[model samples]
Target: MLSPSLPRPLQPRANEVLPARLALSAAAAAEGIQLLTRDFAPWLAERGRANEFRVDRIPFADLDGWSFDEESGNLAHRSGRFFSVEGLHVTEEGQPYGDGPYADWHQPIIKQPEVGILGILVKEFDGVPHFLMQAKMEPGNPNLLQLSPTVQATRSNYTKVHRGADVKYIEYFVGPRRGRVIADVLQSEHGSWFYRKSNRNMVVEATGDVPLREDFCWLTLGQINELLHRDNLVNMDSRTVLSCLPHPDAGAGALLSDVQLRSWVTGERARHDVRVERVPLAGIPRWKHGESTIEHEDGRYFKVVAVSVRAGNREVTGWTQPLFEPVGLGVTAFLTREFEGVPHVLVHARVEGGFVDTIELGPTVQYTPDNYAHLGEQGRPLFLDTVLRARGDRVRYEAVHSEEGGRFLNAESRYLIVEADEADAPQDPPPGYAWVTPAQLTSLVQHGHYVNVQGRTLLACLNATAVKGA
Candidate 1:
């Protein structure tokens, strides 16, 4: 093994670190690690400099540099491989990707004479990059580089080739100049597959993506997709994907959304169970954004048939919780008729586990800060939310809501100082307020801001005890 300090400015590279029970490695070093780059000399030079090894730099072109690269195509782009297909073998088989027993899905491309695919035809960046097999015409393909987040035990995270979901990889077998450039794709994380062999089929390996508490794949693509969601509610955008995949409401060419909606329920009734469709936020007008909607009848109690709050992990990574949670409560009761204005169905239930998603009985009430100034010395509060709650009988409620803007003036109650569950709440807008409501053990589920004997606006915030499964 190389000395740990040898990486130097190269910032360590995640070599391989699987346990003996799950350890898998390359049999031999016939194929050195694959590095995908347009300019190999520079990359090699950098590595050589770092290693203090000066060897003869002999370079030769495989196909004699005769490529089908349409100058108008990608190799000409500002930030991508500007080369086009020189001597690639263009296949005429309009066959499916492969048979199910072995291969899963494949895209059949009609041989274009010259222009071929649009955008960067040579680049494909979808989700975090994965290991790809590289091969020349004469020699079979072999695993070149694994592209996913790597830890050098101490390196940084990164991706290669494509960026969002719709990149079209260079199909060596059939673009302009095709000569058998087929990718045996293994859908995996960066370090999962440390080796890729040429001519081998795409393999599926089981490994955990524990490196990222950071879901950059979903987060980045979600931003690129925000504009797309403005008008369409049918789908969610996807990450690392070149284009949308097959979804029910999506058109023939719709892409698979990056955000995987694990479960979709109408108040816990579990209305839709399949994956959600991703709508791109691209090109969305300023006036348009996602809004919490409800289908109400004339006189019946407004029961919730749908909700859209951000779930999973219970951790507040984004501000879309209000939009993603209630639809999750599985409410069977008719919603209060008065819930017409900016509806805020804030629940203060305890999460079953740090990993579980179920919201159970607990204590916390929904109310507006007294005059919004209760929140602080504000000239005036946004008064934009209409608070709604599900608590025991005592806590009655009211709220100052704005029907036009559609948002809440409530701040997420959090812990500044750790307090015991049996501990006392501080004097000011009392901290330690729990974020969710427990399922049973009923208590007053107050709505509307109630200025207590004191004047702090957010005094009755909720909190929890770390006592797991108590």
Candidate 2:
């Protein structure tokens, strides 16, 4: 047995260094490599059939283990382990910069203080790093089946609070005999829909013999990068984990130095004063709770609706829960431009009521256009028109991706990277915007609460498409 008081080394041996191996795999990746499996779409369909996955919207009264608390009107599970739907009252003192009309509003937010695990396991095959991915079913995904991490579970899930099947490959992430930890960090989730929510994003490298399940498959990093260009092929959890991988090099120089960029983000957080309060969900103003849903009076934003899920491969085969459904398709894009031949993307310091830190670096524009149509030209976001009206020649990358499928219903966003000139987006842009290299953003993502989920997704895209030798 190993000594409990042994001093550990700070760094791995030179041969075991991770970045070199990752770069090797990434550089060798081709757009259409058929090494492991052929046609992911058909394989996903077969898995769907094997799992007998099904989800249907049901009345609140039909929830099996969930009920509306009589005292606070919050929707929660009887065990109080998974998550709950509560109300948040936000009050912004000044005219915060954004497309939304109100600085103050009341809405239902998912409050899950527990930090769950979103881990992806990696192994070497013929000296190339291949990631283990699962064909998971989430009720909120538009297609109902997408590629997810090797082990995605809540504290309640792994702890057996739901009293279901054991999470496969979980031992590789949690126990003493677990795999080598490549990347492990606590990252934030959807701040708008979740109250101070965060999940542990991890990447582990397995060492010993592994039992391959029918629902799981191995693909190289290069293959995963190619899949990133496709719409909703890789789930949000996988994207966030991939973004945390050590990048090769973004560029030699940036418009703003790393110190200056840090100062700017700090100053953005200091300038805003937002007050948020947790209130009873029963009688929140401007929201009406019907038997089937709880939505805004104007039919904008999102609503809380109940769902019944039946999956053959989950920890639990059947369960009832609630999911947040957005009103329309959202647009999330990065405005990229070269400064002295060094590529940089515009980032916005955005504020959401449910965020624990009050602000995070988001994309240049992240909003549903339909939600802001009534605001007209004067109320439009700074670069919304530019992204929406860009010609084909200026577009770099475009794909439709969905949010966290387990808790969100059809919350898809048209993710893009649109090039712009000085006339469309100036160097001395609006107050809340700044330009930073993709490497700088990835550096910040290594820490928590710095880059939001949307920004991370775009950064992953940049790593795959824009960055040379990345």
The number of the candidate with the highest TM-score is 2
Those runs of model 1 whose alpha carbons end farther than 4 Å from true positions after fitting are 1-223, 234-347, 350-470
Report, for every candidate in turn, its global Cα lDDT versus the true structure. 0.18, 0.85
| TM-scores of the models, in the order given | 0.16, 0.95
Model 2: how far residue 45 lies from native, Å: 2.5
Find the 10 residues in a row with the least total lDDT in model 1: 189-198
Question: Which residue segments of model 2 deviate by more than 4 Å?
Answer: 1-11, 14-17, 31-37, 96-99, 467-470
Best by lDDT: 2
Q: Residue-wise lDDT of candidate 2 within 131-246, one digit each (tens)?
A: 88998888899988889999999998899988888889888888665666777888899989999999999888888777889788787777777778889879999888888987
Note each model's CA RMSD in angstroms: 25.3, 2.4
lDDT of 1: 0.18
What are the per-model numbers of colliding residue pairs?
Answer: 99, 1
Per-residue lDDT tens digits for candidate 1, residues 1-470, read 65533321211222121111111111111222233222333442343233221111111111222222233111112232312211111111222211011111111111112211111111112312222221101000011111111110000001222232221232222223332111122111110000110111111121223121221111111122221112211010011111211111111211111121111111221221112111222221121112222212221111111112221211221111111111111111111111122111122222211101122222233222331233353322111111123233312322111110001111122111111111222112122122211111111111101111011111111111111101
